[model samples]
Target: MALAFDEYGRPFIILKEQERKSRLRGLDAQKANIAAGRAVARILRTSLGPKGMDKMLQSPDGDVIISTFSFFLSFSLANDGATILEQMDVDNQIAKLMVELSRSQDYEIGDGTTGVVVMAGSLLEQAEKLLERGIHPLRVAEGYEVASRIAFDHLEKISQKFEFGPDNIEPLVQTCMTTLSSKIVNRCKRALAEIAVKAVLAVADLERKDVNLDLIKVEGKVGGKLEDTELIYGIAVDKDMSHPQMPKRIEDAKIAILTCPFEPPKPKTKHKVDIDTVEKFQTLREQERKYFDDMVQKCKDVGATLVICQWGFDDEANHLLMHRNLPAVRWVGGVELELIAIATGGRIVPRFQELSPEKLGKAGIVREKSFGTTKDRMLYIEQCANSRAVTIFIRGGNKMMIEETKRSLHDALCVARNLIRNNSIVYGGGSAEISCSVAVEAAADRHPGVEQYAIRSFAEALDAIPLALAENSGLPPIDTLTAVKAQQIKENNPFCGIDCNDVGTNDMKEQNVFETLIGKQQQILLATQVVKMILKIDDVISPSEY
Candidate 1:
């Protein structure tokens, strides 16, 4: 230890063992941070576009996730940007930032998670060159901010409004198909996209153009092929009747949604109850049976044909319920209960006193549907009074496929929702990026300062996306991008992008590949912001984490 004096002349003690700590400042710090972030972005780069690769990550628990993600969820097939980053266990703070960048994009835009991280990594790579050329890091960041604005504005100019209504849903379905094309479920992208779009529209309010995703439950079962996936007009739950002898179908049913328990309420605190004689025991048993009977009688009194309970009951109560002609489904999850209430326009009763005829939910038909075996059965609630709540019942060969399909459909659903909120759209296949790159590069000449160089670098970074797409698709990255850029300028057509699928034309419009305008703009703005943050970090200190 050593003593030191501050500016005020006060003495202080200093401890040794500084060897465990490390610090990087200025150029060294910036380079290290850039390298960490760039490494992460590079991992997701190949996962971009339709031909992009999927990442298969294994968790510590040995659960393998394969995502073409584009890995918020660990499935068998995926390489999605967000999914990969979320599953990747990283120590570097900058790398974690890149992960957050992807997550935020997924949360907000629901698509382009990989592309944003890839773009950020490209920008960082370019900024590293600028730093070596003696340009100020902040100056490079400022240039990026300027370039991002230009790209954002350019996206708006190139975007077109897509009109769709109840009578016209093909456009929305096509937009969602573009999203699913790069997913593991792309084999059935058309069917999945239709299901996604219809599910969104069912839960959406066209007048307000707003949708509450909660109302649309995504239900999946591992059994049939992906083609068996269907959208239900009502809620479908993985539950069956509480009893075997209970009728499987209830027509024009009156459902009593209950949160209260079926058995008599137990004491909250510890208590002693000793039976000294057989008569006392008999009286106590009779009292308990009375409680169960009263609860059942209350439902019958309220004219409830079906009872859906949030909590489970004992076999005694189940037997009594079945004998009393009340078909009760016990242990229904809270979410399914709320959906049931909404679908049937019923109220959830917490107490027997609150039970009334008006509180009962009305449904045209409630049936127990069995799949391959009677053991594999689900309760299908349909033709409700409200009927606004819906479910996308997905079936797959295995658990992994079902999980991967959920993530893919999630993106598709979000895309359809975004369009409903705002009908503006842009072409995909990296065409939009190429268009913005040409615009940003041309605008760079208008700047007179060193920011001009940074601006031009930003334009070059923009080419990384189309390049990556072309490369992943087995085409020459530079050649494909060059031809597309040339075509955009020659034909004055901004819709030209990398034809990853080798579909005759390079025009995304002709390919019918559509992406939301807000999503693309958000991607550019987010990538630039993250890169700028990384460039401005001139100091990184790691304290001994013991």
Candidate 2:
């Protein structure tokens, strides 16, 4: 029978026959996987730093979610394009699994999601080349591994030793922020770092224990200049309650007084009472009075001087005290209360206090004004607190800009978190799919039990990181792979950005230099492996087939 053809008149029969051939091919899977990896990597490339752009994705339900790099990668796979890959019978499970692994790795490492994807693509490309060169997959994998180790060593040497103290933190943050883009992302990173440091310091006294808020202090509005107030004997609430009559100046005042807006007796309930319930009860006048008296007596026992109760004050809480002699002031917003508490230098929860210059992280706040007469003013409240209060403020001329900026900020934050917390993991931006391809390449090499292909596959996988970085740095994947090979041949450093000039030629580290080269080499290898997986998608089949 004559062979059938598709619209392009290609041999459909041969294609179908080839499809049925379960035996492994040299480069097909590698190419397809790499393409997929690169696609994902490209999507996130722009979302790098604070200057990075935001991606807005509209879901099938017409819900729009603003996205950063991490979100974009995740949503992209989960929502839209993933089904296409699955239907292609491209080992949907493996592809999804690998992409997830990449995302997790990126989360851990912070900055390399895009790099991972790009390098995976490159790896697949190189795998094809190696196969053509008559190099077995096993040998390639071995070579790639050797190269990756060297790259990693170089990375360690280049990474500055950063101390996690206040003095050293800023400089380290600055170094991390030193990127090609000149955007607020750097500042955001610094701010986040600072917040992290503060959290660390605040909790240093209570390591290996749950965070305690009791040590944190609360202040009253009347406590002028925290240092001036003395410990008062009773809680006081009074209207027209002025500062101490005898003490003309804050320095003259001897007592720390807390004034509130409510009546003399603050309500205390055996059970937690809702605010509305407290407001509704009319018969509890005596109960309220007793509450004040008890509080005052408690203060007096502690040697407090004056407890004044200011009842039904509009702006402040009414002071409740047992004794009549204590002096306390009351105002609105709990500002005075907070100030006095903080000024006392009492151990208090860190969040309640106003953010101070010293308390701010390495990145400072960036302010912008409202544009186009919008009533909503923009405030950028970026800070880097460890698990506490790091926030990104977005201000722009339009709603779109504000939203986009927020997305970018989120992406930057995620990247920074990953980078700071887990520096060891490898990330493939959108290239996780490429990592899948690299795995397939390994499988292909070992198909029908080719031991050599397996070793080569391992080597190629190792070099994924450097290749990804190079691609991110705008280097061509093929050239980078060739360079790695050349370096291996010459026994030179297979890594990029390594300074070997300091060591003497006779030095043992230099004698092998492979260890030094492995870091960069591994990066490239890992990246290429992913890239290859992303690129090749020629065959489309049902999910069950894979």
Candidate 3:
């Protein structure tokens, strides 16, 4: 703050976010905040629908990434909302709120990251007009809260129940395909959607209707074609035998999951050892050999055919284990080790004394598969004792394709899991938004206050989604939305949406476009919450950098 005097020599203070010259207050502050938020929202607006463009994001370190994306916020071929926000290097506080807005949608819903931001941005744009007309920001925020509730309730009213069972999974596959259609791997959406549905079902508990996504692993590799992607009923570790001479395959393997290294334990604190005398050196070497022998003996005495260690193997101990005819894989990560344990129904043996037959994990067959001319080998443990833990091993010609496929599959998998949890769904391609817009607009007449203006603006903001969808799909935005809106009214159909794919119909239900009910509700609620908070911030203050 800096002191200033009026013409009457009265003193007052000026508050600025940065330098003294950049003073902001009241309407100006709200406008600045709204603009900041809209800037972030505008970045994601183009990436809204299935025909949305991908963003190519490049980092300062020269890494190019095109990831899970949409709403046209391409950082690097990415249309995913959460990815673009997380990768964005924005300094604006309100813009950062937009990032958080995207993150909340991703965290709860796992999809529609781009759509959420676009929705929030449109809300802010509408609020800006209300503020310009002298409507209070608080009144605008309250109006939005009401509009959001109306939209949310209308979503539930229009949402349809999707049926699926172990024997009936086609509906789930169709829903997942809708998510994948907007992704970079749309051509293979059918196959990927089937794989995603199967993977979710394999890990999902039908009785509880809850899926522990941790039980499912999505492992990607740069090889073969995208069609080569398949679901494994067991764990697949990107590792091979410690030694080439070791057996490459084992049948009916009794596996040992170990945390301890092959070498003798070292002191936790710093220490030194002296071996000036040859006899002392020989004694020390003998002691080390004895330790290695005991560790190997403990593993073998327990009837373990395969060893997967959390730590790397010692060269001497590795040679000893190979010679002793025990196949071992070393340097496994902790999470992967746990997944392996879950997959094989094995206990992790942290010490040699813990080695027992009951502690072992059983697998029908464990084999090493090599890919590419580079001899990149991965260990495949198939037909496990516990068939619940599975992996979707993805193969693609390039890393970017694999990464994008991973994003696409992730969206599909989340949609499948969501359906299992709450089978209620709404039609996609902006059908839900259009329906909500109509509902909220109809409800606006019920209120007789200045907030009605803001409420009407909220209704208009809801149209931004269908507008973005139609615009991205190369259709005349206003004309297409107007036509669809007319159809929805004439037919009394809530499922009429933009024909983004030009599938010859504006009816998303007939087109089989699906989105989770809870997910759509979440998008509107989160966007409104963020926009309201942004509007309430009529001032931005930061410590002056020295």
Candidate 4:
């Protein structure tokens, strides 16, 4: 009935019940989009500084996420659709933008998701005020571009280069502590920082000037206190032995990494042979058992006390291994196998025929430890040869605490890794922001056009970071910002950032607060670019209705 015949016998279709809706090209669109961006920024602002608060988000199905991540806040609040296929409202569009911004920020740099978002939101908020005062959007964009160059130059000028070694890790450790201050693990920051520094240094590739984070595994268990966490010098396999009679612990173990399975090989084509006599059947069964026994004998001939296989082991092979007093761990994942190969200075043999005495790995000891009331066990392969791979065992009182601790530890570890890669740092607690703001304002004064207003707006946006810090620390934001500016102007100390300590004064360097300059620089660049893009947008189009 939706199709009808025309005069020339041609068919045409009509959508009888359709209705179109559209909104485009006006101040209303700008207002809605800016409002959404501001709303998202407001959510992340309270979680900015060391004294920031956490967000407890509960999903519709009762799942809860306790985090301070800006992307998580944006996802839970603005774009709360059931699925990605749903149409986005104008506000949801802005939320999606922030979500993508934070995702990209996290992937590119491990920290500063909240800081960048809050900064971008502040810029857009300032741009809104300029637009209401009749400043052209293009002029504002031009001004932002100029100010960004000055800010970046100031950043490089202020950053101090660092070195990483046993005696030189104090600065890196302090940076990790600053990164962890806002997280839930601040109570154990000192210990956690030590662990992070050691873990990164252990895996650092001196020639490449990089650390392979994959080599450092983070394993979590819920039972003990958070301070009980320890680092394993080698990889930990989540599985135990393949047979009950196998030795539970093997000291001075020679291990084998096998990618091939233990079961008998299959014929490419389907074929069968029937034996009428019982003696013939018994002979066939004996041949199968001897085949598995021969495989175990090859492992023994190579002096392998422990066997880790990528594929599942046969029961007959397991029995043969148990008989030979060899402990076999079957069904190990490929990733674990690679880590094991790295840890023990061994190679993964893809075929049974390729395994030799030289192919076997060496470990000081291989043991299994049980945890929890149910007695779940994990294999600890420790004291490996030239082992760059290590494991961090995180323990906590409950599931939520463990999750939060892991997140905090990851942030701290990322900062440690960042320093090892670059080693150049700037003072945190808003020291860099205040100094950059002052420099930007000076640069703005030299500009001769309306762009000067936009450059000044950029300077004010930079000030918002320190103001957010003071507000989150429960200090009077306006008064504290005023005092901080006056101190920087009087003493010419770029290190004059808000101090949340005893007097709630301004001195980041004295407080030992610092962060990697790369993250902060990235935040400024990304936030400014996003704000410029948002400012240039004067129209909204929903093409779905058309």
Candidate 5:
């Protein structure tokens, strides 16, 4: 009370107190959120490739559930712990950022969600050191940015040209295996590559003015005899209906193809269907009917007898085709389609007619002329497509194992597809567009120039693989990042998908610039964000300290 202070001094004291409290609260919440995020990441780190293990979670209600690495990450982040952090008045922005980071990290590495968390944890520890050393957050962030640039440069230097021709695909496959633990990668790569090639061939055949199943042959021995001719034609895109007892043999059929899932449309709302909506629905139904009719016609034109659509037809559509005397079966998903295609000799498309019990026992149909070893079929498939094949198989002894296997398979497929279709430009997982704000932010982080901004703009391009895998693998949006990374390591071999001899050629250089530039941008943005996040954590402290 005896001390007198100037007006400026009084204002300074008040501002200092407010700032100190704000920092304290922010730091406390940030630490908690970061810890939770790191923990979630750690749980799924080992579940990266097809060879990655499964995880089991038991609910409080005595329910035992099993899931893959990606699923686990999603579950953990969306679990009660994350909710508690939010409830504790954790900064929503930071919490949400961590959640997204977790998702992105999981998607980027497939099995490295845990690794990312650990990395983040390490970063946090390092940040603490920086703080102790009295390093300002700004300086730390700047240093990290420099370090990230170096890391990205290293990644680029290490990146080999992605090749896809038959001559060097094995080495490419081996490269993917370098960081993985599963033998399924080679098996799946061969199988899927073969399937894609066969599918392409089948489509090419159908597109031919002359549709002929006679041109296709069943190759291989099952139960000791030469395989019978059961031609599978196009991609089965449908599901089978759950109905009255169909033939046991039909039900027992190991491989059938349909154009759509068999599940009926969900019940509609009680509100009366509008005439316009009804008309549109009716038009779609008519189009579907015509499509099937044309498909049957094509089958007849091609002299195909056993046909399956990966997609499903309506009851009327099914009846119409069945009445037309075409032997057919339908499968619900692409997984089932692949199984059917493999059973039918590599043909992704099914021929006309339902498969008889006797025919089902024989190799259902042969998509390609190759047989025996999976490698041979894969080679044949690749040759047919003029592209390369890479498969990632997940093997486990339990349900968790199977789930993880499927997730790995889906990721590998996406990587391979991107390499083949888009020349290996890294796109967002699931077609998510990078927001304009994010792009701007990313550009600003680079040199303050338009060229750098344009170069960084590619970061906004959405990658469809992760999203597709997440949707297909049953993981939520939160877990996609982990799954993506796992898959990337398993499938990313620049030299794997490209023709090695063609390297340094003008054509190669052009393709390289186009492909690698986008990849570089993606790498840059990811690295930058990671470093920025680390810097932001410098001020964080344990809640217990408060």
Candidate 6:
């Protein structure tokens, strides 16, 4: 476009405000993209093994987050995508894939997030070397695809059944422990793993191929030790009683889960009611009180010993219920009310007029436990009738620790759920990766040429997992890898993996280390696809073009 003339007849340039920033093209762009990926991988490299350290992230909002590097990376990427506030990197294909893999892995199997990111980064890093040797990206991608299929098949062959019989919870607990190994929850792995395993199993609906995670409520209080975390048979609400005079404990409690509020209903639209006389005002007060009284009476008539309200309970209703020797919890919300109904075999009555004995729920005990003071109390409704819902009470020393522990427990629970759903797992400690890598290389030899070279590169990329584990565990990566490879090759034991904590051993199975076969398969599929996508990207358009 040509320059435009202003009203004063002075010629002026017509262009966007030029912003100055560094630009890269061709080799520089590829290098920057790969470096960005490696940078993410490096952030998580140190937090890989059982002896891994935690990452402490402090945001600009003064919120502190203490979690594993995978969680931090996943969260950061999510925020970046949502806000789009960071400097735009049109060529950072690897970064985009890192986020995609982290999120999808997390959603699919809830573990192996770090492994996915690291392996994807390592694959691209390897591809960079292959590219230098004149191998095309298309050939690399094809080889990766072939190698991924073989790896999946190998994973299936090596996976073992994860049973949950009447007496054996070892496999399930071990799976939970593996998921928690690189997390802060490793500090209380045994106890927390047990809690996680039991929590998932308690609510697992295997016949339906579903595990209702919402049924397992995790309630955190910041005053006790991590060891204090325990699973309750029923729900716990972090709310105090509606009335001070109400009984704090009620055994053999007949519970009522109310959706309607025990108060005067407001007009749906704008309206005016004139109280022209004091007698009219008095009548209004009496009508509201009587309405609340009738509501409380209806609850009592339905054999309700405790009333849990989804909405507000007026002062008149509280006083009436308290005088009637009833324990009432108000403002319980819709979710808890639904959970309570599920736990106690109760039906939710939409209106107070519909109250009946059949709609009332039963609990063994309804008790209020005061934590710090009256203002900080939790209601524990324990021993519900044939309850499938349960609660895990999490206790920690501080806010950050509590949140981190919750995250770790969530991952543990998800892994347990995976085992319950699939009941198949592969040897951990990099055994699966090493075995798959070996198989991929053998398959690569069947197809000679540039494709074979790319296949070999993919095989080499699989070694990065164990290498990372060894490096993070303070062991020599080459030495450990050599020993593991020798054991697997000579003894023909796919279970041979580096026992990093033990220093010089290669028995991950005997050490009770395992990874969900589904998770590993997902990691491979995602990592390879991401690497292939990045390898095929030979051009990087400037952000301004959009």
Return the TM-score for each candidate structure.
Answer: 0.95, 0.42, 0.92, 0.90, 0.43, 0.89
Please count the clashing residue pairs in each candidate, in the order shown: 22, 143, 17, 0, 96, 0
Per-residue lDDT for 36-88 in model 3, tens only? Answer: 98898887887777877766566667666554442223233544778778867
Best candidate per TM-score, number?
1
- What's the candidate order when arranged by decreasing TM-score? 1, 3, 4, 6, 5, 2
- Residue 536, model 5, lDDT: 66
lDDT of 1 by residue, 428-477 (tens): 99899999999999999999999999999999999999999999999988
Would you list the rank order by lDDT, best first? 1, 3, 4, 6, 5, 2
lDDT of 2 by residue, 1-546 (tens): 237779897764433454457433445554454445445545544443223455566555555655432222223312111222222223343355346535543444333344444445445555656666665555555555544444444344433333344355453233333321223333343453343333333423333423322222211222112122221211111223333232211221223233333335335766675546654565465566675565545544544342222223322223232125544433423432332333232221223122222321221222222334433222221221222322222333344333333333333333333333433322112122223323344444444534345334544554454444445445565675455445433554322221112232322222222111122233355553443333333454554433
What are the per-residue Cα lDDT tens digits for candidate 5 across 1-546? 124458676522323344456554444544554455444434433342223345565445545554332233223212111222222233544445555555564354322232233334434444444545555555555654544454444444434455544344432233223212232323344443343334223432222222222233222222211112122342222223222222212221223344433333444666664556777998877876676677567555654444555655566656765677555555345664454454344344343343323333223222322234532321111111111112222223434334433443333333333333323332122211222212233444656433333233223222222222343344453355444333334554222211112233212223222222233335345534763674566354435433
What lDDT score belongs to each candidate, Candidate 1 first?
Answer: 0.90, 0.36, 0.87, 0.80, 0.37, 0.79
Model 1 TM-score?
Answer: 0.95
Q: Best by lDDT, which number? A: 1
How far residue 479's Cα lies from its native spot in candidate 5, in Å, is: 34
Worst 10 residues of 1 by lDDT: 14-23
Deviation (Å) of 246 in candidate 5: 12
How does candidate 4 score on lDDT? 0.80
Residue pairs in collision within model 6: none
The parts of candidate 2 lying over 4 Å away from their true place are: 1-42, 45-56, 63-91, 128-147, 157-165, 168-170, 179-285, 288-546
What is the lDDT, from 0 to 100, of the residue 520 in candidate 4?
89
Model 4 alpha-carbon miss at residue 214, Å: 1.4
What lDDT score is found at residue 346 in candidate 3?
97
lDDT at position 354, candidate 6:
82
List ranges where model 4 is wrong by over 4 Å: 1-21, 63-91, 503-505
